[model samples]
Target: MEVDVKLFGDLREGRFEQEKTQLEENSRVIDVIKKCNLPLEHVAVCFVNNCQAEFGQVLEDGDRIAFSPPVGGM
Candidate 1:
């Protein structure tokens, strides 16, 4: 299956802003993070097709996955 991935904050520092990636059927949110070479600890949140998602959330073809890294601000 193919999915769209979006990286935010530090997550995008050395990665593309967005990408179209391929994964096996039933791939999960954490699988995408691993494929992107991002540390699991760096992700603060994840959204699938605009809805908040958990690491184990199974991904579907054409699903849009967005990841946000930990942010610090006043």
Candidate 2:
């Protein structure tokens, strides 16, 4: 079981390289975040398969997970 993870915005930039990760199924969003060594404070938005999902949501195989920071411009 594997899931596709897509990082966006500052999150992607912070990770240096590699925008995607294949994680085991039944893993929660938080698990991936931890595996990536990403700080919780840097996360502002998260989606699963186009729907807003919580960090605790258990990921399923083939799920598309997108992560991004809060973006604002003036």
lDDT of 1 at 1: 97
Candidate 1 least-lDDT 10 residues: 65-74
Scored by lDDT, the top model is: 1
What tens digits encode model 2's per-residue C-alpha lDDT throughout 29-50?
9998898877888888888899
Residue 34 of model 1, lDDT score: 95
The TM-score between candidate 2 and the true structure equals 0.81
lDDT of each: 0.94, 0.79
| Best candidate according to TM-score | 1
> Which regions in candidate 1 have their CA more than 4 angstroms from the true location?
none
- RMSD vs true structure, all candidates: 1.6, 2.5
Q: What's the lDDT for candidate 2? A: 0.79
TM-score of each: 0.94, 0.81
* N/CA/C clash count, model 2: 0
